[model samples]
Target: MKSSPSARSWIAAGVRHELLTRALPALRHDMAAPVSVIRMALLMLKRQVAAPTVDAAACEERVALIDNQVGELVLAIRSLRDWELATTDDGISRSALVGQCVMLMRSAFDLHGVSLEVDAALDPQEDEHRWPAGAALRYLFLGAMGYLHDGADEAGAIRIEADGANAVRLQAVKRDPGTSPSVLDAHRAPRALAIDAVALQSLADDLGYAVTLDGDSVRLVLATGN
Candidate 1:
């Protein structure tokens, strides 16, 4: 398969289709957090409203809290909706793209007794670092995370790091002494909810990246100088 730009676009569409089909549960799961926050805020608002002495400031605060959570819910949903094209685009920041992937999968991670964390060694304001076909790498990270989630019989964390241009590393840190499937097994998501190996590799190749599984780490390394 050619790793040309058009070909990569088609691959990204395939991933988006798979996510919409297989990752629906996870997508729904991911929204639960913000919804829970809204619910709690509503409860507080009700109490504040019903209180004998209505504290206007407290009532306004609860309303603001609800509004913020609603905004988060909207952004969470739009992330999934926007990602079909976004994933194929180049020059996306490593941190921002990875954060969206984490947002889309965090609830699923919690369900499987795993935590997902991203650690970037770059200034959020100044980091202009990017790789070719950068956005689809979010699919790769999500796939690796799904791999970790599938293998966990105990609690664990997928510590993802973005360092040096064009590379992101996900290290599976088991909280206790336990085993996990290698990063290669990230394709083995139950119900086939993850990105498959062939498309994943093609995306990596188009991005000038190499995906490697070393012990507990899944690293995406891009070629130097573009």
Candidate 2:
């Protein structure tokens, strides 16, 4: 039987399946957005070309719009290609993995009415930090993360910081859902993140790392020593 830590990790692992399921609809939109515009532009261009009275400047404008939309379509296609090619190996670049995962799962986040953003502080220096490929997806979805001590950006994006080479800080600045949530959601609100904290701390302790939980955020670190 798996130990408690392993069991929880197993639970976290299931979230990836749910995330991909929710993300597909949004991914479809990403691929379709540029195509939709390109189609509209083509229709306009076609009308201009077949006009009984065509203006050179108007035709040029339509052609230019179509060109721009086509460029956008190319970028969308390329992003899909990259997403499909992303690796789920044991080790991967933290930044690239985080970015690709964010692109893949950000829409799933939207279902919870939250947006995830990583601090630019986690530049190449930290992005160079190594994390297991599947580990990151688990980490973000797990809800055990760090400080609201001015933790978010002006746009109120949840900040995922690089705590260290093998650590991550999650700071949530959430929005009001404007409804009386069920008891479960009320308990699960950002203000009550200690659930994740406690669970992670138990696992961290077993692994010789440490976790700290405050009212707003929890910082999980892979400490060099206790």
Candidate 3:
């Protein structure tokens, strides 16, 4: 069994509470804030169960579920946190690389009970788009992500397919009869961002990339020639 402190580190440091709360709602049904506190307490209880050096058979599955839940939470929290702390001067060619975006989106996918696959083939020698320094890049992507998983149901799985040419597509398993892609698009678009969408759009315009939504899918296209 993983220790409680280790799990807490995984929760607070590893995942973004905002993304977890905003992106995925299905997972939150069982995760009450105070209940999470109790679960943390239970981790300690497991160690003292004595004789059962491990957990009881019935508790094994529940423990696994909790661990997975906590892990997903950790990833979501960390992705957004990293974005906030990242500087454009970091000097990496593709400022907000497609791969990094995919990794960041994984937490949201997990929350939606979705799986993600990436097939990026960026030219290693190529340095095309240079992202500007500040909160613009982070917020634009974060806002877009907020919509990607909004109100997504658990009928099937959401698949985010990104090709080598920088074509990113987000498809939920079954159409979210419960929500509209426009709502999410509006949230990610320049006009609707609570943060600085104008600057983000300007940077994206300079990079020759744009975010769009069609029906139940969201697409982000970046240019190799940018």
Best by lDDT: 1
lDDT of each prediction vs. the true structure? 0.64, 0.53, 0.47
The alpha-carbon lDDT assigned to residue 88 of candidate 1 equals 52
Worst 10 residues of 2 by lDDT: 146-155
lDDT of 1: 0.64
TM-score of each: 0.55, 0.50, 0.37
- Weakest 10 consecutive residues of candidate 3 by summed lDDT: 189-198
Off by over 4 Å in 3: 1-96, 105-108, 120-130, 133-135, 152-155, 161-167, 175-209, 221-226
* lDDT, residue 50, model 3: 51
What tens digits encode model 2's per-residue C-alpha lDDT throughout 109-140? 54444577788865556336454434433334
Kindly report which residue pairs in candidate 3 clash with one another: 14-74, 15-73, 15-74, 15-77, 16-76, 16-77
- What is the descending lDDT order? 1, 2, 3
Better of 1 and 2 by lDDT: 1
lDDT of candidate 3 at residue 39, scale 0 to 100: 81
Pick by TM-score: 1 or 3, better one: 1
TM-score of 2: 0.50
lDDT of 1 by residue, 131-220 (tens): 555445555566556545554334378887875666777777776454444542363355654444555555555444568756566667
lDDT of 3 by residue, 30-116 (tens): 334435754874676566565456557646665666667677666555444444434444423232454454555665455444455
Off by more than 4 A, model 1: 1-16, 19-78, 86-90, 120-127, 130-134, 151-155, 178-199, 202-209, 222-226
Error of 1 at 146 (Å): 2.5
